[model samples]
Target: MFCYQCEQTTRGTACTTQGACGKTPDTAALQDLLVHAAQGISQYAHRLGKMGIRRNAADAFTLDALFTTVTNVNFDPDRLEGLLRNAAALRDTLRADYAQACAAAGQAPEALSGPATWEPAPDLAGLVAQGQAVGIDTRIAALGADLAGLQELVVYGLKGAAAYACHARLLGREDESVYAFVQEALTALAEDEPSVDALLSLSLRTGAMSVTVLALLDGANTGAYGHPVPTPVLMGHVRGKAILVSGHDLKDLEELLKQTEGTGINVYTHGEMLPAHGYPELKKYAHLVGHYGGAWQRQRSEFDAFPGAILMTTNCIQQPAPGYADRIFTSGLVAWPGVTHIADHDYAPVIQAALAADGFTDESPVRHHLAGFHHDAVLGVADKVIEAVKGGAIRHFTLIGGCDGAEGARSYYTDMAVALPQDTVVLTLGCGKFRVIDQDLGTVAGLPRLLDMGQCNDSYSAVKVALALSEAFGVGVNDLPLSLVISWYEQKAVAVLLALLHLGVKNIRLGPKLPAFVTPAVLKVLVEHYNIMPIGTVEDDLKAMGLAA
Candidate 1:
């Protein structure tokens, strides 16, 4: 069960015995097996695609499988076992379709090996055994650290893309190219004789795909709920039976809000769902109360203290503490053993839990935090931003955002945000915005110094704004007065990083730490190609970004 696909991998190295995210050996094995099964499906699906056939089911399943393998998303062995069986079944279907398509085209069907030829065992233990056979170390042993690390890099990016795609798909939005790339890249990963250069190229392509998926998700979210606006969300809660909706699933949050409406139950966004408040449609619901808690890592204490039901919509789930474990429920791809899983997005059970619990008796004093300054919101004021830059009202623009973890070093984001000069407009995204959202950076360039741009996928928004600013100033994006200080914890941040690299964005400082899976040689290649570097102390980074403060 060697897993190092996340930033918090044990000691900044691979997790050999257990996951730092509370994933047990058995659960890790199941995730590995599920990923292996997806690879098998992709082998067949990719072939079918080349044969002028579209295996959309296999493509969809492949993304979901990879997404489930993401850190802290699904810890329930039973749920993973179910996905494994489903993957095997999906692979079989794709295999038969591939054979039929080949026969009809008068071409010989290739006999796929590796995971393609393997079979999942009859039971959970058997499946775990099968999964253990194809864990990360197996690939490292086969291809060596450099290339295998590159392949894992690609896979992690794909996982991040899949997460955004899943959220988009829930709102009935998707792109066929994103799905095709998943199959094609997974097929490449399943190859025995992998090429470093080819894998490196694939990593960039995965980044490009991440960019596409993020855009697709952005369109889906904005289309469904309307583009985010500069709305003020209550940092304080209201008096009522409350349900806290966490994770990045806007659709799930909308469903819960709809169900709990007029029932005296207030639905508060948590973690990545904080941006939901800025959506016109979602904000139209009066019962959609203010946000509760901070980032995902703080959920244990936050969820424990909240006297209401808790619903996890996606990743960012930690082990449920005994005190408030039962009050919590899982929806979408989030699952924990013994936790109530909500299928079909129904909120009856979640609502019941909220109703059964003691509501917030006394409301906290009124307080507010500004969120939602998405690409459109920011771009709508582009004239002022451009003028501010020309007039020296805004000296610089820094994009400081990414996933938030429990790491002590994560405070660097806050420090940097706080330390940035007032003339610099700070654009932020992801749950990491929790660090800077509280700071009243005041107005810069006729806008708030700190602009909250939706969730992690809204890195797209940052990219869009950068491109717009570059065009407005008649310069390249790299030449704009901008710097990206990204803090990554999980696969989604990796995907976003790839997207940045793909866009030829350079000189970015990434931290709290570098991924353990990134071999030195691979890191050297990235640094040489993209000018990427690990983040340093806030003071040094600020100086590097040309900030005197």
Candidate 2:
């Protein structure tokens, strides 16, 4: 298996035998095959879209298939096999329909029939050999760097889209066109005759779709649960049995809370789900407890020490420690080969796991975290925030957040936070808060300046705050007195960037070396069109933002 689609690729290169995230060679190969099949189906769908032969059902199915293949998302071999077969069947039906359509038009149809066979690229050595061959090709090699980079961008973007769509699906919302578009885009990449311009265009469209997906998820979240409000989450010891829910799926967290209600099982948010504590509907759950773990990557030790079951709903899932292996239940796309998977997003199995596992030897020994900073909640206090800003009580709004990584360079985030002026308000999202989120940035009046706005999906909350601030100040978002200094480690971040672009958000300060995967040409487009810049020293970045260094 040769996969390097994540921050945790073994040794910063390729995952030859097993993924650092616990994906075995077999599962990785199956995932690749799944992606290849989805591409095949998508290529057919693309042609159909161009020909006006719309197939909404086929399109939605194709989207789910692609989404299922994202890194650390789906690990169930049986589920992967099912999707593979579904994609093949869809491709065959579409191909047959295309042939019939051409026949009616009196044109001969090209034969590209197949049962859709995909073998794992022999081995890691074989992948290196393929890379070597590409390296040696003079004409093709000239664009090799660009090609590989663009592929990374599109792949990451697709993953992000899948995540957003999954959240939408949880809310009972469906956009068949979006699914069709995703399938069509993935299929375009499988073509032998690759078009740089074409791929670049698709990359932008991915960003555009990101905007739509974010809107859909935002609607789903806020509509189902009342807007987020500033409710103080407990960070003290709670007396009772508790279950910790992590990852980014709110639906999963909500369902677990419902199932465990009145059963003496207390629920807590960990990692990305930490933000779930912010929503009004979720906060009302008296049994919903505080955050237990720091970040997703810290699960090995944290989950091991925890006395309750850990439910991971999405990405950033690592190998389970023996201590919590049996107690961990994964729902949605997240999967680990032998782990108990709560399929169909069902909570019965999860509830069962909780009951069986000895939850909190004695009512959580201590409560040590706070969550639930959704948009509605933040907006409810918008007037006070605006007043503080105008009064010069809150001089700046710095959005310093994104995914966390293993790199030591990540320390820059913490250092950067300390360098910010006292009056500056630090707004955070995602696991990136691990940097200096615990620091006391001091409160502007009675409100803490260090406001945690939930998880990465909560980036939608950041966008909402930006737009609202702009409207309140009677200026454009970019014109508002706010700066987004973000750090990204995966595809969901890609989608969020795309959403920003769709909104014409400019001058974002991005860091940790702008994804090594972005092609020079693509980088040019981003820099020229979006004015996106990389993070220098925090002091320098802060100075540029018009704050004292």
Candidate 3:
């Protein structure tokens, strides 16, 4: 039951009894079993691919299994156990196929050990018992913290990359290279006592692969939804039956909007989906209404107060409270006990639930929030931005993006955003922008000071914008007057950070705290190689970035 994969780990250490995100010991144990089983499946799949035999289904399953184990994504122990059983079955099937292929080729098949040869228990008790041998702590005890931490870093980064790959696959986008790297990385992690240097190299390779998947996701999104255009979204209530769709799955939301069209149901974006309103294709829906709430961590209170059904399309789902549990529905790898799960992209159940529930009784005052300032939109104004910079009207550019959580130190982002100099523009993405989305940072050089990129995956947009500026200014990205102050809560953010380092971006300030799984030795390596630093006080960070002193 040991888990420490998120920013909010209990007391900055492992959660041995229960996760701070409300995952039970039983669920945690089941998640560990699922990951181990997936690694076993990857072992066989990787070998099979080498033989020029591809199994897309197995690759997709590996991604789904790993994504489900992400922090706060799945808490249904029954569902996790079901996945574990499925993964074991898949591994056995692949192993036999690989053996047959080798025999037919007149080559002796290799003997498998570790998770590949181990058998799973038929029941929950046995599964928990099986997890004891495969847990990260066992590896830490045998290999020491530095090596264990490096291995976990690669594993976590792979999980995040898998999540993005899954999203792209749903949109009918598949990259065989990404799938191959995913299998290769997982199989590498399952090896017995790899050297620290090898693990570190694999970690960076995982980061490099993450950039590919993110770019794939970005293409999937913009190709399907059209390049994001700056659009003003109403932040007020609309009168009608309503359904709130949260998480980061734009495809799911698009389908729901299509199905709910002309129905009395009004669909509102919540959490990371708030930025979906900026997409031209998705925004074409008349009933797509405005955003409803703040970040994912505040959903307990926010969902209860909303007088309609809610749909969670991805991770960051907390344990549902009893009051709204029945009306909440989950899809796309998010599951909670007693919550209705809409499978196969079906939203009829969600639509019915919205119609049956009490929606907003009355309309509220109107407000607006700006989003969709994606790469194209920002780059369209590159001339003006460059002029401002050269004329000394814009002193600096800071990117305050990444995951937002319930941690108390998260308030530092809001403070930093508000305290930046009037001439500096703040670029934001991810749910982290929820902290300062409503703040009026005013306009600088005729552009709004706060520019909202897309979701966390849209870190691609930020990267693109930075590269464009660098090219325009005839300097490297790190030499530009830009600072990256990122806040990470889960593995996707880890993948994004790895991508940043892979791009040779340095001196970035990351907080509210560094990952618990990153041993001091690993942190030392990062500091020495990349000059990455932990976030200091808001004022201190501002001064350090040359924003203010």
Put down candidate 1 lDDT per residue, 141-246, tens digits, no spaces. Answer: 9779997798889889989989989988989998888888998888888874688788888999998899899899889988999999989899879888999988
Choose the strongest candidate by lDDT: 3
- Better model by lDDT: candidate 1 vs candidate 3: 3
| lDDT for each candidate structure | 0.88, 0.73, 0.89
Error of 2 at 256 (Å): 2.0
- Model 2, range 325-378, lDDT digits (tens) per residue? 888888876777689888776777767776777666444444334455667767
lDDT of 3 by residue, 1-549 (tens): 778888899888788888999998888888888888888898899999999988977889999998998987899978887888888888889989999999999999888777787687978889888876688888889888888888889989988998998899999988998888888888888865588789888988998999999899999999999999999988868888999999999999999999999998899999899889989999999999899989999999999988899999999898888888889999989998888888998888888889998898898888899999999899998999999999999989999989999888899999999999999899999999998898999998888999999799789999999999999999999999999999999999989999988999999999999999998888999999999899999988877777774
Instruction: Itemize residue pairs with steric clashes in candidate 1.
Output: none
Off by over 4 Å in 1: none
Superposed Cα RMSD, model 2: 4.0
Model 3 clash pairs are: none
Q: How many clashes (backbone N, Cα, C below 3 Å) per candidate?
A: 0, 10, 0
TM-score for each prediction? 0.98, 0.87, 0.98
What is the Cα-based TM-score of model 1? 0.98
In candidate 3, how many Å is residue 314 off?
Answer: 0.3
Off by over 4 Å in 2: 8-18, 49-57, 76-78, 97-143, 192-195, 362-370, 472-476, 520-525
